[model samples]
Target: MNPLVEVSHLEKHFEIRSGLWRTVSSHVRAVDDVSFAIAAGETLGLVGESGSGKSTVARLLLRLITATGGSVRLEGREVTTARPAEMKALRRKMGIVFQDPAASMNPRAKIKWSLRRPLVTNGFEHARIDDQILAMLAKVNLGPELLNRYPHQLSGGQQQRISVARALLLRPRLLVLDEPTSALDISVQAQVLNILLDLQEAFGLTYLFISHDLNVVRYVSDRVAIMYLGKLMEIGPVEAVLQAPRHPYTQGLAASSPPMSPHQRGRQRVLLAEQPPSLIDLPTGCRLHPRCPFRQTICEETRPELRELAPGHWAACHLAENLPAPQPRDT
Candidate 1:
């Protein structure tokens, strides 16, 4: 099966201005030289800390924010440079579930109106949209009564379900889920996840699941990508990368997970101190080397390329030699 979504050498930057006259200017490297792909019906989890540029990648892929560089392709169709007219044709197969349901929804619009917005935008007729809306609502386990209520009247999970329903109104092949469950309670989150799984099984949808929570990623993702600063440090099957992470950052993330039993506790979690460097004046070479406990002289002068450390596994680190070689993950 071919990839449903592909991004290559992607970059996005923000120009900063400071001082009394705002004369001091610099560029913040939000996303830098990133690349990845998602095969049809597969969920690729993008995991990273708050400032690791995960959100930037999401916006760029959706074309909500223009890309400073690189390209994005959907089912081999180029979307990077698509004009307004061209984007309309491509967006029918793509949609995004934002992190915050409230921010994405119109305050004045009823649930039905909100749900039908995307479908109408995609050029569906009123009659066709009504049928699709009701069917989509049912698919998310929502009731017909919800269509008449405002967003405030609905529970958090309900609102999110409506968001999901709206996204699926067009039967998009790919959905960019940006921390879809972050704002909901655990019970609600579980319900949402179950709905997502059921929907995927039913629709055979491809997902780009972005989140900072490794635990959630473990459950929802088929594979995971570890990111730091503005680049991918490691990526592979969720089990392979999470159980035994090859990169120091990824290992740190795994170690951070509490052991279920006292007997299972021994690995030293990488303790990172001090805040990340300012993107406007990023450090030379590897940005992670500054906080990496195993940093060596070479780490400060030469940036390591993302290399295939194992079959379907990739990582970037100069001290990779000091760590154990990539061994096939035992499951």
Candidate 2:
């Protein structure tokens, strides 16, 4: 079957100006030639360092911000050139839950008001609105007593559950979860994560789960994609990419993340010599060559296209074949 979502050569560039005239000077390639797909009912975890264009990709996919150039298709319909009415209709098939629960809702509004807005706007039956709200609240494990309270009256966990509940009101097939649990406490985080997993199974929803947390990604994602400096460095099944990352960038990220077990805490890690380069003027050739420990002369002269290193696993690196085997991450 065809994928639920497909992106091709996705690119988003921001123009920067320096002088008083505000003349265009350079472009920051926030997302450059990135491409991936999410199969139906699949969660593709997008992981990267801050400012690596993870959020930018999400915005571009939803057309919350326009793309400089590329194609985004949802269920085979092109999104980039969609008309206003068409885009509005397309949005009904997808929903977004942002990282901060407090910011997602209006402080002045009651929880019921927030939940009812989407249903009312989408022309959901007016009489069934209250019943629908009640049902969705139950799915998120929230009680009706909180519905009359303001957003500030609820706990952080309660607020997030409400946000999730609101997003599902329209019965969307795709949900873009952008660090959905990052702001909650550890205990609350687990609760929210479990709720998301349960909801996905119950709803058969496809997810574009974006987060910096590898452990969370491992737990929720079937496949994971590693991104850096506005490019995809490695992508594959979660185990193949996380446990045995091939690209130096991926290796560096996997190593720096908190170890899974006490015994693995002291294991040696791949360390880069310097930080990432400026996006306005990215380094030539392989973007990662400047800091890659295994970079060779060829790496400095040519950019590596993503190639299959193992079955169903791909990496963009000149030394992927020559690099020493990586230690398996603790299961």
Please name the candidate that would achieve the greatest TM-score relative to the true structure.
2
lDDT of each residue in 262-293, candidate 2, tens digit only: 45434423366666789987988899888888
Question: How accurate locally, in lDDT, is each candidate?
Answer: 0.83, 0.88
TM for every model, in the order presented, reads 0.92, 0.95
**Candidate 1 residue pairs that clash:** none
Q: Which is the leading candidate under lDDT?
A: 2
Model 1 / residue 78 / CA error / Å: 1.4
lDDT, residue 169, model 1: 82
